[model samples]
Target: MLYNLFNKVSSMNKFAALTKHFAAAVFWGCMMAVPGWAQSPGGTEKELIRLQNEWATARIKGDVAFLENLYAKEFRITAMNGSVVERDADIAVFASREMKPELITDEDMKVSLYGEVAVVTGRENLKGTYKGIPGEFALRFTNVFVRRDGHWQLVTHHSTEMRKK
Candidate 1:
């Protein structure tokens, strides 16, 4: 009975190993079948950050159309305070706010790329007035961009404000 049980277990192990290898080959084959899009990491990273900077400038200028063009159709923004805003709502925030011509200066910026996706992370000092109300926030912002159809669009964004020590 012991010998029979060991033989059965060994057969099952062989079957499992065979299945694992088969699945791995299928996955690799599918990956190879997928076409690769031409993504330039150097220029793309620069363009994406430039686009985000332009978005902030437009926000200060209260230009919704510019913001609209800068963002992807399905943009998701999350504030440091855990507040979430979608594409429309994000553009609306700039439209509704009365801008007093301010500026966002990025202190430190880092850009990284993976395939067709690029992420830009930076610390920015923002100074502005909204609706005649004085406002200032030091934000660490992350902007994610994707290259699609030979165009880079802002896909996801997040901002977190640090507490004063």
Candidate 2:
């Protein structure tokens, strides 16, 4: 009878261990399935910051090729003037001389990440001309990027002109 009780107790302990492991496995599986639950590797934020800087440089230089690769096909921008510009149209304007950007500097940038998506918000100090009309302004901008095919691309951008106090 003692031997039988010992075997039964051992079996119960084994069962409890198995149950614990199974619960852990399930928890991990659920975590992996949920978006942004998994811990991201380091340097993602720095890479995104670099991308933001590159975007400003690309705009000033009218680097169409870089812009093409950076912007997703469905990308859209809500301009400071409240006009919505699609990817192709924006790229065209950048390629042409109509949208001249003498300088664009980003400041006080913040980046938020969610698994495959990231949002960047900052102020852009811009000095340039559009259609020979000189303009200088500060804009508060939000740029959304999505990781696609292992590369980040701008999916949406919205900017509002910052009015002087």
Residue 3 miss distance in model 1 (angstroms): 57
Q: Give the per-residue lDDT digits (tens) of candidate 2, residues 106-129.
A: 999998988889999999999999
Worst 10 residues of 1 by lDDT: 34-43
Superposed Cα RMSD, model 2:
4.0
Q: lDDT tens string, model 1, 65-151? A: 888877899999897779888999778768887555487777677988886788899998888886788878899989888877777
- Compute each candidate's TM-score over C-alphas: 0.69, 0.79
Q: What local lDDT score does residue 44 receive in model 2, on the 0 to 100 scale?
A: 80
Error of 2 at 23 (Å): 9.2
